[model samples]
Target: MPFTVYEHGAVAGWDVARPLRPGRSAGISLAGFRYRSAGSADLPVIPHPAVTVVVEFGDGSLVMGDASGWQQRGSLVAGLVPGAVRVRGENVTCVEVHVSPVVAHAVLGICPAELDRTVVALDDLWGRDAARLREQLGDAPSWEDRFTLTDALFSHRRGTGPPADPEVVRAWDRIIVSRGSVRVEDLAAEVGWSRRRLWSRFRSQVGLPPKRATTLVRFRHAAHRLTAGDSTARVAAECGYADQSHLHRETLAFTGVTPAALAADPGLAVDDIAWASTAPTETA
Candidate 1:
């Protein structure tokens, strides 16, 4: 697979290394990135449905926190952060994996809802194994090798953990296919479960409750469109928002930026080159 490199905006040296193909795991994908700058730089941690994992090997430290301040972290395994979080660092190199919430339980060994609105260090979750993997990745000769190793690691662990209920998986697929346009009641009806039952099961297994998850999915679709240079009116109308103001409020809630501002963001400008879809490898 070939790597498509991209710039990191105003940062002195910002580059993204996209994988040639997707990972073998369901709803999992990887992207390798390297950034260096004399001055510190920040990247927005916009709200999204996927739980993000970032394993870094670089001289500069990465901080994950809000507008107040940040705390040091080795490797980031982040779940549904409600507000804006920025990752600030210099001279960073990492392989980032995005795991859809549907498979997050099996892949990350916990419901994303448990870790929602927070970032946790990999060492805390995976223990010493996390450190060993970091060392191995740092020693790897190329980005492809690092990605392969990382993919293999996640695949190995995924098999050991319990899988989400099949019905919940189906429901999640439905939500994605509709781009969050489907109603939770309709999802429950399709799965042969009552609305309350689906809510309890989905909240326990996938992460957020049905309604919250739906909103996030809808907003994320709009965020991508905005990042892709789509007009606010179009994104709003197309993404299921009632009106432009509806889009504006939700955008601020998820990204803390207005539609036009979020659209103009430079970090998101490189998504086409770096971001892989949450869809799995075999099907995709």
Candidate 2:
């Protein structure tokens, strides 16, 4: 697997796909680089961000959007925020872009309110500006230009820098090492802090509470296993769930689909799980 830098910025470095597995994606970050779906391969939707960039190619290509609770299909290349969807095959090849919260903060320096949520498409906010952006950025544009475009599109939503709380980082690190099972109290003690302090900082930097963040990370791990054809019972046990049902309930809550449904569809089940140094988002 050859890794290439797709883009770079003060916040991160985006690298191109180096096939983590047969149908999985490994780490590839150069902050704020946009990704279009590959036209040759059809992909299944997994638990993912509300806003993402997708493209299609070949016949029988379908993309499903799990907006809120509704799942629908179409050429949903523009709007993908914090939702899950299934992408049907039409010989479509898809590539997903990863955005940094810090870069988003840089873009929206003063208006912290805009940072409250996620943006699905550049055109959604810019309208005609989206076309102009595509036109300026041909098949492959300079990394600097890509970062600039991303920054400009998200500029109005930036806020204060991520929290300076060491406890938050410590807790996040614990979850990563534990594969998402460290107790909040245990983490607090390790950092010599209280649970309340840990929560405050975790929420500030990651925009989700420690418990929820832990759950999300755990779900992502399970999704990876399920997509890779691991049985629900096995995944549940490995992820610290009480049982398969426990894992099923949590997966459905975040993904709106059962483990069986996900595993049944190879594209969605075995797609890439984007694990980042900061935040992780699962993509197909």
Candidate 3:
């Protein structure tokens, strides 16, 4: 088989497509999704290191919330949301932004800690600003126009906040560069902070403690590998689990599904459509 730029996978619905263009910054990217039909149940949402903002337009609305039946309508801003949430709507058109935790505080104007692995209405965060955004996006002529408007707003808002701690940003970069395989102790040492200092700073600034961050980063890598069709043992070994059982437990804990089940998830099967970085949206 020929090797392609197959990095990982994401989501899409009927007539959905990738963003008009990729975000210029290393910390962000945008995807536009549309669905012609409505789902009866909430679709499962998986978490990664990046915080997400979903802006919806069109005929119907959807809720982004957890399994206990908690959900919120209007645009969603979430940080490291764990477990499954349902996304059900009809004739949906939306642009979803993936914000690196490293810069999320600046872009979103709140600590990821405040979000605490939960979904909230974007309006709650930006108040009237959120309403303005919804209006602008809905009125925009095209997906590209909406995306540009979004980027401009984000750029303007992001510049208003103080930059995230430099050391914290470096630590996050290291984790991604290492594919989540780096040691936290080593990271702390490199950042010239004691373990306790690193823990406090990272948890407050990035929303996850150093240890948990590593686990989530590692789990993210493992989840992608599973979705990419690697065997349990291979993914476990390559992603640094002690054994397949260790991988099993962690994957189950994160996704609420066995590795096999997660690999075959229809929700994620379409994820590549939403997140395939190099590909443009495919129309049908």
**Top candidate, metric lDDT:** 1
Better of 2 and 3 by lDDT: 3
lDDT string for model 2 (227-276, tens) is: 67788999999888999989988877765678898777544423442333
Looking at model 1, residue 164 earns an lDDT score of: 83
Q: Candidate 2 local accuracy as lDDT?
A: 0.48
Model 1 regions lying over 4 Å from their true place? 1-13, 70-72, 276-284
lDDT of each: 0.78, 0.48, 0.75
Model 1 clash tally? 0
lDDT of candidate 1 at residue 270, scale 0 to 100: 46
Return the TM-score for each candidate structure: 0.90, 0.59, 0.88
Greater-TM-score candidate between 1 and 2: 1
Task: List all candidate RMSDs to the true structure.
Answer: 4.2, 8.9, 5.2
| Backbone clashes under 3 angstroms, per model | 0, 33, 8
Among these predictions, the greatest TM-score belongs to 1
User: Global CA lDDT of candidate 1, please?
Assistant: 0.78
lDDT for predicted candidate 3 compared with the true structure: 0.75
Query: Where does candidate 2 have its weakest 10-residue lDDT segment?
Result: 19-28
Better of 1 and 3 by lDDT: 1
